[model samples]
Target: MANKIVVPIKQVPETKSVKMDEKTGTVIREGVDSIVNPLDLYAIEAALRLRDRYGGEIVGISMGPKKSVKALKEAVSMGVDSAILLSDRAFAGSDTWATSLILASAIRKIGDFGLVVCGERATDGDTGQVGPGIASFLGIPALTYVSRIQDLSDKLCRAERLIEDGREILETSLPAVLTVIKEAGEPRLPTLRGKKRAKDLDVQIWGNDELGIDPDKIGLKGSPTRVVKIYRPKVARKCTIAEAKDEASVGPAVDRMCGFLADKGVLQ
Candidate 1:
């Protein structure tokens, strides 16, 4: 049997278009369009490349509302063999820790896996904790910020990791997890055949009961973090728009702009 590599993905609202509900402090998804988390695409691509070279199955997993099926289908179009979605009211309001626990349970139910790949972070939270959190829950070695995969065999996997100051090369055995960085590479586009196959692929939907997850460890009660408040930062800078108003006034406008910058300590 070929090794099975699982990739966990998320559907996030387009950052620029996201609107927050001031009363509930939650994202307003009504008008906001959602897309697959960009970083996770790199992870998916990495898994696809490995499958091409080593021969294995790639499975995409996601935890969200039913609408997230779009994200899973998108993964299918990217060549994932199959996909799974974990959805239920029980999963609502889960923090990173709770989310990872749920994902770990689903992975266990899969019964067999050689590797797990994930994006470094989600654009919404930007905490960059879930990937490592999943590895910790599974008790597997996790190589994060991976920019390049040097080797991947049945027994071993080697990759180069990007850090703040420099890069580090790491080698871990199979059954490990990797959280890839954007430096890895751009993801491949879905082909027409892949899209056709995606439409026919039956995506499995699992819930807390299906995975036998504990109710106490799933929803709001299971989450450790709480939002205190949500508000946009105040803009404190004063702006003065200067216009020449006429061709002959251009020189004066330039002089005025230089004076304003100098007064603001932007120029010496």
Candidate 2:
């Protein structure tokens, strides 16, 4: 098997509580509870399973604020051999495309990896673009919605992917990237020993300087997609309460209610 595998992970604000910064066009993370993107846990599990079967090093990598280090630590606790954090003010406000570039650069710096795994999508973004973007940046083959792996060797791997109509089996060369669906499997909880090791092991932090990424290819400055404006669409509803005067009038009341609903374009 290849010597190394990289799993790209993300930490996102809880879906129910996520807020965006209108001024900056970025997520407002302060005072929000964050968790590793649920889908990414499956990717991590897939990496761990691959290592178990193929004998390779597994590394978890993420690009986010310093708080993201916590996500990486969690991955280490889940049996990742090591973790890397990409953090810097220069990386703030990156969209999926720029984020992928930064991550692909970091992976390139890490060198010699046979596989890269990532979640099908991030809860906060729901764009499902980063994985393929990373593959594009790295110039490698990529597979999305992978649900099962049939075989894995040092130079090649084969897997089943879920598609719109059904599923398809695919085989690809090594050094490939796979974006895994949650249906692939559940992630294992961290063992006590793994937790202790995670606490003791320092996660290496890399920045633009370390990865030598071009300033024009990272952060808000590099993001091609822009949020020109963000506003809550107003919701307007007119409520008409109908009450029947008595059983004798119930039929008339029902007719009136239906008429009101029809006037409101709620019924035919």
Candidate 3:
């Protein structure tokens, strides 16, 4: 197994502040504070555990604007050995496919790596596709929804993954991708030393120029899927209160509920 492990993370708007542009069908990130994608914390924790058990360097990578360096710094503060930020205007508005392509290219640039760990999905997109997409681009096995790592070696990884009805164990060769789940473990908080190191670390920045990926296969231009429309579902309800202070009012309350249900066609 190689001595290097890569964990891909994302910066996302705080859940409560997330909004969408109905016209553009995109997230409204302006004026919103962003944090490291919550699920990705699990991925980072998993990588850290692996590094602890076996000796390896954990590298955190992210693709976004220059400001996204904050997320990388946060990852460093969480105990990653190093971090890289992929920033370029050419990478704006990338869909999952385009994103996976960009990240896979970066991994190739990093050269020898034994494993890639990622979160099950991003909260914003919630697609759960990038991890598998990276595996597809890298021509490696993709084990997703991983809950636990049972064993690991230079050549192979055995893990437990969640399925619809239950969990199943899977063994895949090295140089594979694993999309971890929350069951892995809770993420650790950053320490004072880690924070100081993060402040001093010079995070490397790479772009399309460095990765040399085809412009036609990146950003919005390369995306095959598009959001045509975005709108919030309307939720409207009418409340009717029938007081049953004593047994005398119980019969009327039941009759009122039945009538309301019948009117709504729910009692048919």
Candidate with the greatest TM-score versus the true structure: 2
Candidate 3 local lDDT, 147-190, one digit each (tens): 99989988999999999999999999989999999999899999
In model 2, where do residues sit more than 4 Å from their true spots? 243-255, 261-268
lDDT (Cα, tens digit) per residue for candidate 1, span 1-268: 2369999999999988888777656566665799999999999999998888888899999999888888999999989999999998999888899999999888878857988999999998898898888889889889999999888877889999998999989899878889998888789999899899988888899998898877998787888787779889999988876789899999988998999999989999
lDDT of each: 0.88, 0.92, 0.93
- Lowest summed lDDT across 10 adjacent residues in model 1 is found at 23-32
TM-score attained by model 2: 0.92
What TM-score would every model get versus the actual structure? 0.89, 0.92, 0.90
Candidate 1 lDDT for residue 34? 96
Name the better of 2 and 3 by lDDT: 3
Give me the runs in candidate 3 sitting further than 4 Å from their true place. 233-258, 262-268
What's the CA error at residue 162 for candidate 3, in Å?
Answer: 1.5
Query: Least accurate stretch of 10 residues (summed lDDT) in model 3?
Result: 21-30
Clashing pairs in 2: none
| lDDT against true structure, model 2 | 0.92
Clashing pairs in 3: none
Error of 3 at 140 (Å): 0.8
